[model samples]
Target: MPEIKKYLSIVALGENRDKLARDLVGAIARRGCEVNECRITPLGDHFSAAMLLAGNWSAMGKMESALPGLAEHLGLAIQFQHARPAEPQTDFRPYAAEVVAPQQPRLLGELLDFFTEQETNVVEVSSQAYDSGLTGAAMCTLHMALQVPVNHHPQTLRDAFMDVCDDLHADGLLDPIKT
Candidate 1:
């Protein structure tokens, strides 16, 4: 018999972030589905989550129906779709970094392009904008995980990243991911 593989990509938002995540994960696991990837973010007054699950078609069908009702009962918005298999991991060095700067348009776009040119793969990214209550200035903060291939020089990559941050007038720091 041929192997059967299925996946689910889900995104949800709700006011009760913690409760929603706990309940949703518990519900899926109870039904025998594997939660492969999950990222939850608290958006001040709201919460958002993205999750990937692996299960059989029948299991997915159950979730497809059950999730909507569950979310509605909790006053949340939910979206889901069947997902494709993930790409294989490559041999690379992982790094984590954070950037902070004055809020402005095009900052993220420029940073993304710089990473592309440097042959870096971004594993995860989270960004937020907020008012600096003391200074009354707008600020943007970005946190990211990146994979840099072994072929590249670590110092070189760090220098290039810092250069970009300098141009944006942002402050940044990069460090190796500890195993």
Candidate 2:
């Protein structure tokens, strides 16, 4: 039997600065942990990141023990939890959903609710609001990575999704993710 590798899920927030990413990744490398997946971005004046670290039991423990000191030294707010590898989902197909529209309250919530009603699994979501350069109108854009069940007909789902977008006064697209 293969040994089960340990995993750690970490989220950190700190004031944006140079060398922060290098320092954080270096710390993980020094402790012998490998970053399996990560998303780092600047949000306003702060830098935020979420990472999944993988390693053997000893390496995981070492990294976990060092987190508090690292957080203090870097002036970051850090949180971590034990995690397990995601099980393969052969019955699901990857898809991407994109929406762009005039900014409106509850727009994101309504879109999320629609997906929830269909029992679709939303794996990742990113959204931003800005003023359109042409019209100087407030606008919002949302992109989501989804694991859609194969049992749902793609055409049917796309049609339904389009209807929801029309009702929300948003332009949207739902399509398969190209590798």
- Cα lDDT listed for each candidate: 0.86, 0.94
- Supply candidate 2's per-residue lDDT for 148: 94
By summed lDDT, the worst window of 10 consecutive residues in model 1 runs over 16-25
Give the worst 10-residue stretch by lDDT in candidate 2: 1-10
Report, for all candidates in order, the number of backbone clashes. 0, 0
Name model 2 segments beyond 4 Å from true: 1-4
Error of 1 at 170 (Å): 1.4
What's the lDDT of the predicted structure labeled candidate 1? 0.86
**Model 1 residue pairs with clashes:** none
- What's the TM-score of every candidate structure? 0.82, 0.96
In candidate 2, list every pair of residues with a backbone clash: none
- For model 2 the TM-score comes to 0.96
